[model samples]
Target: MQNSNLNLARKWRSKNFDQIIGQDLVVRILKNSLYLNQFFPVYLFSGQRGCGKTSTARIFATALNCEKLAEFQKNPKTEFPCFQCASCIAMQNSKHPDFIEMDAASHTGVDNVRNIIEFSTLMPVLGKKKIYLIDEAHMLSKAAFNAFLKILEEPPISVIFILATTDVEKIIDTVRSRCFQLIFSALPNDSLVDHLSKICEKENIEFERDGLELIVNESEGSARDAINLMEQVRFSAEKITKSNVQKNLGHPDDEKILMLFAKLSQKVEISNLLGYLSEISFYELSATFIWGQILKLSRVAIYLKYGVIFRTNFDLEKISEIIKIVNVKHLINVMEIFCNYEQVFAKTSNKNILLETLFFKILDHSNKIEVKTSSLIKEPEKKSSETVPWATFLQKVEALNDPLVFSVFKRAKFINAESDKVIISFFKNYEFLLSILNDTRTVWSLILEEIFKTKNLETQIVEKEKVIEQPKADIEVEIHKAEPVLEPLKKNFKSFQNSKVDVSDKDKWKLANYLLESFPGDLIEVKE
Candidate 1:
C-alpha cells in the first residue's frame, strides 16, 4: 500500500462547503451571511480539534473568493470555491493576495502583532476584500492583544479579521464581542459510523459492523482519531473483524473481560483468578481502562441481581461464574472500591501495586456480602431460596474510599463473606492491586462497617491470628507521624520573650490594642 494513500485524513479533507459532512447549522448560517451588502469584519470560529473548524474556515474563504459564485449557484457546480478559478487556486495554495493566515501561538508577541496591523492597513491587491485569519488566537499575549485592539475595533471596509481558537475563554471579551462567533459541535455517533463505513469501502478494507461500531464508541466523537485507529487496523491486516479490531486497537474485548469477570463470579479463589489473568495477558491493557472494564462487569452483575434482564457481551461461562458468587449489593460494593482507587490512576507509577492493593482490600472487606436469601435466621425459610446474604472476609487490610479498591473488586472473580469476615478475589493482581494498597492512604475498615450496616447487621474486623513476639535490636532512626515537626509550633508559648528584633511604632500600637482586647491592659504615662 502506498504511504500517501494510507492516511485517510489527507485524502478526505473537505474542500467545499458541500464536502463538509457535519455541521449543518454552521453551513446554513455561513451561506446565508455571505454575499450580502453588509459584511462581517470580524468572525470567530471555535471548536475541538479534528472537528472541521479549520477546514470550515478554509472552505468559507474559498467560497467568498470563488469566481463562479453566481454561475455555479445557477448550474450547481459546487457549494464552495470553483477550484479551477485563479482565486480558488491561489487560496488553495495559500498564495492569495487577499487572504493571509496566521498562527497566533507562534507569533503572539507585541512586535509580531504590530506588524500584522501594519499589513492590515494596505489595500487588497486582488479579490473583493483582504482577510486576516488567525489560528489559535487564544495564545496571543496581553500586549499583543492590546496592540490589535485598535485595528480589531476599526478595521478598513476592505479588511476582514477571522479569529479561530479552541479555548474561547482566553480571548478578551472586547475581541469576542467584535466578532460573529460560531460554535462547532461534536459529530454524532451515527454520523461518525456512517462515515467510517464509507471510508472502509473506499479503502477496500473488510471490517465487521460490530468492529466499526467499537471504533466509533472508542473514538469519542473525534473523527480524526477514528480514522487514525482505522489506519492502525488496516496497517495490521488485509482484513478486519471485531476480534481483530479489539486486538489491533488494544480494546478490552468484552470477551476477555467477560472471561475474567466470569471467573470472578465464581467463588473467590487464587487458582481461578490466576487462570483468568493469564488468559488475556497480551496488549498490556492500561491499568486505568482495565479497571474501567471491571467496573462495567460489576455493574452487569448488579443488573442480574435486580432481575433487570440485560444482555451482556460476556460469554455464558463468564455469566455462569458471576451467577455463582455475585449479588446486586456486592456488585455495588466492588464498584465503589474500584471507583475510589481510579482517582489516582493518572499519578501512580506502579499500576501493579495499585491493582494488588485493590484485590487485597476487597478480600479484607467483602467478608459479609448480602444476597437475595430469605432463609436467614431472622427471615423465614421461604425467603432463603429467593436470595441469600453472604459475607467474604480475608486476612489483609483494605482501603475504605479508594477507586482501586472498587476496581479490583469490580474485576473480582468472586467475593464471599463469612459471618464476620470478607474475602475479595481478583482476576490478576498487577498494577491495579499494588498501587491501590501501597499508595493512597485509603482506609477500608470503615467501608466494611458501612457495607455490613446496609444489611441491617453490625460487623467488625479482628486479626485472624496472633503473632509471637521476639526481642531484637530495632532500627536507630525513628519516624513519628503525629509529632509536630515545626520548631515554633512545638510549644504553646504566648510570645517570643527573647526576641531581638525591635518593634516599630505601628507594630507596638497593634500589639498594644491586641493586649488590651485580650487582657484588659492599660498603658501607663511616662514621667520625664
Candidate 2:
C-alpha cells in the first residue's frame, strides 16, 4: 500500500519527452538523435537536483525500447514513445528488467563497479537495449571509477550507460570525456510559477498567485523544492495563503523587517529596538534576512543613482527616501560588517546577545558620525593675531617638507615656548630620538624661528638622569685587582693609541706593543 499523503511531484512526474516542462531544448536534441538512429554508448546529464535529469534518462530509455517506436520510425514524424505500449507501461512503472538504476551514492565502491561490469556483458531480457542509469555518479570512489572506466569506453553493442550528477566537477576528466554531455538548467521563476499553477488546477487544489510567488522566491530555482514546498502548504490548510507559506517556511515577518529598517534610517534609540526585538523569536535569522533585503535595496539604489532604470518590485518612493539618507559607501560598510560577523554569529551559543551587540555597534557608529558633524558646525571662529598653540604647531610640523626631521620632532613634548627660545623634552625611552633631533638642532631652529617670526629661537632638549648603583665592597676589590698594575704607563699608551685603558700601573709598554701589532693597518691611511 502507498502512503495516503500523495506526493504531487511523483504523481505528476513527466512520463515522456513531450511531457517534460522547461526542458524543450533537451527534448529536441533527443528527438533529433532518435530520428537519425544515432546514439552514444554513454550519456552524461549534469544539473541541479530535480531539474529532470533522471526523468529525461528514463524517457530516452523508453523511446529506445518501445515496440511502437519502430512503427513511428517508418512514419518519420513521431519521435516520442506511445505510452499505451507494454514496454512504455513497464518503463513507467519501473518494472522493466533491462532498465537498471544504480544510486552511486550508496554503492560507491569497486565491488559495485564490478557488479555493473559483470551485468553489462549479458543481453537485455526484455528491452532492445540494456540501459544503465547511474545517479549521483560523482560520489563513486576513485578505485570504482578506475574499474568502470574500461567498460564505459567500449560497452556491448546493445548497452547504453547514462550518468547523472549534480556536481560534474567532481567526476574525473577521463570519465567525462567518454560520454555525450547534456547540461540541464534550473527552471526559471516564470516557468516554475506556470507549472505550479497547472498542477494546482489539475489536482483541484486552491492557491493564491502571491502564495505561489513566495514559494518560487524560496525555491532558489530548484523545481523539486518548489513542488515540495507547495505540497507542504497545500496539506497544512484548506487554501494556501501568504501567511501560511511564511509560517511553514519560517520566513521573517515582512512588515517587522521593513519597520526595523525604517527605525534604523530614522535613528531610533537602540534600547527601544531591543525591546521590540525581544518580543520576536528567531532574531538572528530575522537579522540575516534584513541584511539581505538591505543589500538588495542598496544595489537597486546604486543603479538608480547611476541613471539605470532597473526593474524592481520595491516601492520607488521608499527606495528614493533610503537613497537620500544612506550613501553607497555606508551601505557597503554595513554589508561588510554583517558579512564578516555572519560566521561568528552562526557559531555562537549566545546569538541573542551577539545580535544585540551588533545592533548597538552599528547604532554607536551612526551616533558618532552625527555628533562629529554637529561639532564641526558649532566650532568657533579663530583669531589671526593670536599665536598657534603647541598642538597646532605639531600639526604644522607634520605638514613639513622634510619628513625625517618632522618624524623626530613629532615625538618630543613642548616644555615651554618663549619669544627667543623653545624648549622640548623626551621620555626616557625616546632619548635616542631626542639625541638625533639635537644633532640637527641648528637647521630645525632656523626653520622654526622663520615660522614663528622670532630671532634666535633656540630648541632645547632636557634629558633625565639615569642613575647606576655601586657594586658591593668585595666585588669592587675583585675589580680593582683585575686591572693592570702599571696604570700611569697604560694611560700614556692609551693616549697614544686613542683607546680606553684601565690599569693598576704594571707593564703598560707590553700592552701598547700588543695593540700595535694586532692593528698594524691603524698606523696607515688606506684609500679605496
- For each candidate, how many residue pairs have backbone atoms clashing (under 3 Å)? 79, 7
lDDT of 2 by residue, 1-528 (tens): 252455988877777876787888888888888877889999999999889999899999999998877776677566569877788888877799999999999999999999999989999988789999999999999999999899999999999999999999999999999989999988888888888999999889899987888888888777788899999998898887777888887766556655555555444688877777766654546555555665566567667666687765456566666567665665555556667788897888776677667667665644333323432144775534433555565566666655656776777766666676666666665655554465556646655766665534344445666665545542323234565556454443332324444442435443344345444533333333
Q: Candidate 1's C-alpha lDDT?
A: 0.68
Q: Model 1: how far is 174 from its true place, Å?
A: 3.4
Q: Highest lDDT: give the candidate number.
A: 2
**Residue 70 in model 1: shift from native, Å?**
4.5
In candidate 1, where is summed lDDT lowest over 10 consecutive residues?
A: 386-395
lDDT of 1 by residue, 1-528 (tens): 353653787677778887676799998788766644356888999987778788888888877767877765565435456688888989877789888889998988999888888888899876777888899999999889888888888899888888888899999988888889998887787888888899889878887877777777677777888888877888897766678778876676776777665554443675556556666673366666677677877776777666565554445345645566566565676787787677676578988568756765555544554455432224543533212322232123223333444544444433355566545444332323434443322455444555543322222233334554434443233556796566654665464334233334644464444345545645664433
Task: Please give each candidate's TM-score.
Answer: 0.62, 0.68
Model 1 residue runs over 4 Å out of place are 1-6, 35-38, 70-78, 264-267, 297-325, 363-528
In model 2, the clashing pairs are 484-504, 485-504, 485-505, 485-506, 486-505, 486-506, 487-505
Model 1's TM-score against the true structure: 0.62
